[model samples]
Target: MPFYHKLGKIPQKRHTQFKQPDGSLYHEELFSTIGFDSILSNAYHINPPAKIDSIEKVIVDASPVEWDAGLRPYHFKTKGLKFELDFITGRKPVLFNSDVIMSVCRPESQMDYFYRNATCDELIFVHEGEGMLESNFGFLDFRKGDYIVIPRSITFRLVHKTAPRLLVFESAGPIKTPKRYRNEFGQLLEHSPYCERDIRAPERLFTSSDKGDFIVKVKKENKIYSVHYDFHPFDVIGYDGFYFPWIFNIDDFMPITGKIHMPPPIHQTFEAPGFVVCSFVSRLLDYHPLAVPVPYSHSNVDSDEVLYYADGNFFSRKGIDYASISLHPGGLTHGPHPGTTEAALGKLETVETAVMMDTFKPLKLTNFARELNDENYYLSWKD
Candidate 1:
C-alpha cells in the first residue's frame, strides 16, 4: 500500500508510554520493512508478540519443484481441483520461479488456526465465494473478484462463509501499486485507473485478551513451522501505518481504452519485483474505423505471460473456459486465437474478466500443473 491508514486507538505520538487499565504498559511493537526506512506501523498489543510457548513440530514442505516441461504454451483447467479442509494446505502450486509462485486453492472449510507467511507477500484473487479476512490490523470483508494483498509477516486467518476458490501468488518482494500510477509522494495520480478510494483497508479491529495455547503456522524458507503461543495472535489494541493488509476489487477498476487497441500495460493493477499483475474487466473496445479491437501477435522475449480466466467471455482465446489458466512462456509468440481477430473486427465492447501476471523471469511448471495441462494448446493458433 502507498497510502497511510490508521485503525483502532493510537497514542498522540509514537514510542510513548501507553499504560493499560492495570497501570501496566502496553507492549508496543514496530512492524517495519526495508530496515525501518520504508513503510512501517506501530502496533500495541496486550501481550508480547514474541512470547512463544514452544515449537511443536514442523509441517509440510511448501516449496515448489520445477517439472521437466518443455518450453511451449500451456493451458490448465483448475475445475478438477479437489476440495480441502485447510486454506494453507489446499493451495496447489502450478508455476514457479525464484521470484514468484502461483497456486490455485479450493478450500471447503474455514481456517481453524491462524497463519502467517513470514517470507513472502501474498496476493490472493478471490475467484469464488465470500469471506472475512481477520488480521491483527483489523477485519476486511471480501467477495468474489477481490484481490487481497497481505504483506509478509501479517498474522491472519480467513473465515469463509462459503467454499472459496482462490488463485494465490506468493511474491518474494513487496507487492504495491504500479509506480507509474503514483507521484513522487506515493499518492496515486489523477490519471490512474483506480485511486485510494478503491483500496479498502482493515476497518474493524479485533482485540483478544484471552490466554491459551494459540497455534500460528508460520511459513518461512519453504517450510511451515507450528509455533505455539500463550496468548491470542490478534491481541493488538491498535495499529497505524502504511504497511498493512489491504483489498482491491477488480470490478472497481476503470478500464482505460483508446481509439486503437491498448497494450497490456494499460491494465496493470499491481507490480512486484519479478512480475506485474493486470486486470481485464468489462469495457468498450477500440473506436477507430480501421482498428483491430484484439491484440496483435507478439513475442514475450523477456517475460512469461500467465492469464487466469475468472468469468465472462475471453474474446481473444479459443477453447478456454472459466477457471482455466493459460501460460505463454518467453520465446513464444502468442496472441488472438485462430480467427478471433477477424471475429472481433466490429465488436463494440467486451465483458471479459481475467487476471494476468507477466513475470520477468522464466516460469517452470509444477508437477501438479502437468496433470491438468492442455498439451495441444500450443497448436491452438493453427488456421
Candidate 2:
C-alpha cells in the first residue's frame, strides 16, 4: 500500500511528519501505482513490478549539498530538506550536503543524489538523451522533454548510457499537476487541455544483481556520509500505479493557438505553489492588425522572473546562446528591446525555442552561479 496525504487541500499549519517504522527521521513506504491526487500527499510509488528486477538495499534520508554559500539567497531555505540517490553510473546510492561540494560529471552521471525540501516536491525535467528508470513499482523509460515528479523520497536510479543531461526543478512545497486541468476527484478531466495521455511513463525493464561493495551516500544536517548495501536497489520485480517515472515531451506541449498570441500563461507545463515551467517551441506568430511578436516591456514589482534560455534564438534577442540563463527580479523594467519589438511586427512565424521558468519568489544567486555569469545581459536591450 502507498502512503498519502491530502497535500493540495491540507492547510499549511497542518502536516504529518512522515517517519520510519522505528520513528527515526524517516523511511519512505514504497507503492506500486498512485493516483494523481493520492500522489500529492505522498508519491513514493512505482509502476507494476514486472518492469523491474534487481538486487540492492534502498537507502533513504540523503541530502547532497551541491553548494554552500557564505550568504545563500533568500529563496533558499536555511532549514532542511531530504533527498535520495540513484546512480546511473552503476555506483551505490549517495547523498550528502557540504558548505562546498564539487560534482564535475560527464554525460554519464546519474542521480548520484538530490535534495527535496520538506515544503516543496522535486520536479526532474529530462533535457536530453534516453534512459530507463528503476523504481519500487517497476521500470519506466525517460526520454527528452519528460517531466518526472519523484514526489519526495522515492529512491530510484537511471540506467541509460546515452548522453545524460537534466533540467532540475526544485520547489519548496508540494508540486502539483495544475488542479484546473484535473477534475474534482483528482482525475485528469477528459476536457483537460493536456490529458494524462500526454504524460509518458517508462517501458523497457532491465535488472541486475552484480554485487561487490555497493556504497550508499547520505546527507543530513549539512553533511554527507556513505554506507555499504548488500543488494542492488533495483531489485523490484513488479508494480502498477498512477505514480511512476512518466514523460511529457516538450514537443507535445499543446500550443494555445490564438488570433493574437497570448502571454506566457499559455505555455505553462508544470506548476507548484510558487513556480512554473513553460516550453517555448516553434509556433506561428500572432495574427492581428497591430500585434508585436516581441514581448512588451513591463515591471515585475512583486516577483522575480528567471528565464533559462534553453535552445534556439530566444525570440529575436540577437546573440543568445544555449543554456545561458537570464533572471529579471523585482524592481526592474523589462521587455523586448526597442527595435526587436518592431522587428517582430511583420513576422508571420517563429522557429525559435526556449524553456523558461518563472519563479514567484525572488531567487538568490549562488557564488557559482555568479561566477558563470552573463553580466551584460541587461545591456542587450539597447541598439
- By lDDT, the best candidate is 1
What is the C-alpha lDDT profile of model 1 across 1-383, one tens digit per residue?
A: 78788988788999999988999988999999999999999999999888889996657788897788898899999977889866788899999988899999999877888999999999999999999999998999999999999999999999889878999999999999999999999999998999999999999999999999999999997899999999999999998989899999999999999999899999999999999999999999999999999999989889999999999889899999789999999898888988889999999999888999999998999999988898898998888
Cα miss at 146, model 2 (Å)? 2.8
Q: What is the lDDT of residue 329 in candidate 1?
A: 90
Question: Which model scores highest in TM-score?
Answer: 1
Residue lDDT tens for model 2, 229-293: 55454433333344454556777776665677588877776666666677777787788868777
**Which window of 10 residues has the lowest lDDT sum in candidate 1?**
56-65
- Which stretches of model 2 miss by more than 4 angstroms? 1-106, 109-120, 190-193, 204-213, 218-224
Residue 158 of model 1 has an lDDT of 91
